[model samples]
Target: MTFSADYLLDRIRLKRRLRIWQGIGILAICAALLALAARFDVFGHGDHIARLWVEGIIRDDVARDEMIAELKRDPKVKAVIVRINSPGGSVVGGEALYRNLRDLANEKPVVAVMGEVAASAGYMTALAADYIVAREGTITGSIGVLMQSANVKGLMEKIGVKPVIIKSAPLKAAPNPMEDLTPQSRKATEAVILDMFDMFQSMVMERRNLSKAEVSRLADGRIYTGRQAKNARLIDETGSEAAALAWLKREKKVPSTLEVIDAIYGEEDLWAGAQSAIAKSFFDKTLISKGLSLDGLISVWQPELK
Candidate 1:
């Protein structure tokens, strides 16, 4: 059977189109299978582990709050590991997070793994965990409270800057650095700071089971190495997260089969964090990328002063 060239060309084109469609159909079938497997959790077990990374200043922000809330609500999650590398922040902010962590611990095994430095309020939150682990050289345990104010009175005088204030109360501008602090105001502020310090001491005592005297000695706003913390009975152990998980399994009988899930801040959260990083990057390259910088919000519990 002799065929025309046009007919043969059309037949070839039709075959090529059919092959393309067949390839697409195969791809679609594979995709459908994958979707069904994912939907049914075919490979998904009850081991829905989650992790939370608490880096830098432990701020009283929506991101941190939402993470805590999700951890509490996730039933599939057997335990939570809070990876802390903060120096700390506002006394109230640290306390709020500590309280939240404490509550979360009650429901599930919440373990804390200290990164390079978890001092002051950072350690305060760590105490709320069922177990606390630190690296060998980890600088932890700056158990204290602090209030900082810039005393610009000297600079103001040097620059011939005289400030006039109108306030309802005598102590309204008590912490004004542009002027000399009155003895009465200093005393009042000191009293308030002492009260906060006392509360911090109390929280430490409750968590570590240390007597008032023990806590007082350790809570003198000092940083301790992981070994020192262990010796002082401040930290439960001196190790990493893996060691902590092993301990939990052996000592606490958390079961080896219990899944180890790192509670990440989710991909959606990544968008916001990325946005924040981009915004911060405009001011300084190291601001968002590195840990130490003076251009941003400083954590109150941070021991190192630049």
Candidate 2:
């Protein structure tokens, strides 16, 4: 009986030791998993500032809008910094980005940091920010709308080709390259440009709190340096991204120590992007082959330096 009792006590001790080791292993695994989660922001568990880089030609993208929506929904994102570096692109692209950024601004503080060139639609995007910051030499402020068309009537005549069109109205196929543009069509095109320009001008006036005369002076399709823009009240300040962040900390009450992480949602499908590029190239080539240029509504600063 004494031997059996001693054996039972030994068995109890071993079982307790085994349970302790198992608990330690479980805790170690939990700690590792937690570290991984923090690193990847899986649960959005910590405070951070999101940096959104908008470089190259801007295009209207549904995926981009979705990503911005995600940024709005993220609780860990205390503020947003939009870094723009482009000569601008389609007016619709810039307008869409501006709208999304404004929506994001409603949820969190947002600032824009201009890079080398932020003109036309780029400037429009900057206007969406709650605060604007640009480098001293940054080229900006080509505020206007544009449309271009070409007349290939001479080339068509030389090639012995005849153009045919059947339309319900005189202006239905008004600006085709194979034909001449009527006076009525020219006036119609100008009207469209003017209407868009009005929208852009109004956006600037309201965003910058400038009077009509002030906006009129700045919105004449001229580029302005960052310093000039600041003087003209086109931008709020002349500074870099660091200065922009400092402003957020000092004025907006965001913590200065929060980590800044890039807000790249994910890489767009490679084939989709490639296919779009190919399609654009094909379209441009086809137009040129027919003695014409790409004609569309755009707000871009395409400078030809010689």
Off by over 4 Å in 1: 1-45, 266-306
Would you list the C-alpha lDDT of every candidate in the order shown? 0.73, 0.83
Candidate 2 residue-wise lDDT at 246: 94
Top of the candidates by TM-score: 2
Backbone clashes in model 1: 5
Q: Which ten residues in a row have the lowest lDDT in candidate 2?
A: 271-280
Per-structure clash totals for the candidates: 5, 0
lDDT of prediction 1: 0.73
Q: Show model 2 residue runs off by greater than 4 Å.
A: 1-40, 43-45, 269-295
Give candidate 1's error at residue 138 in angstroms: 0.7
lDDT of 2 by residue, 67-106 (tens): 7888899898999999898777787898999999999999
Q: Could you tell me which 10 consecutive residues in candidate 1 have the lowest summed lDDT?
A: 275-284
Q: Which residue pairs collide in model 1, if any? A: 49-261, 50-262, 50-263, 51-262, 51-263
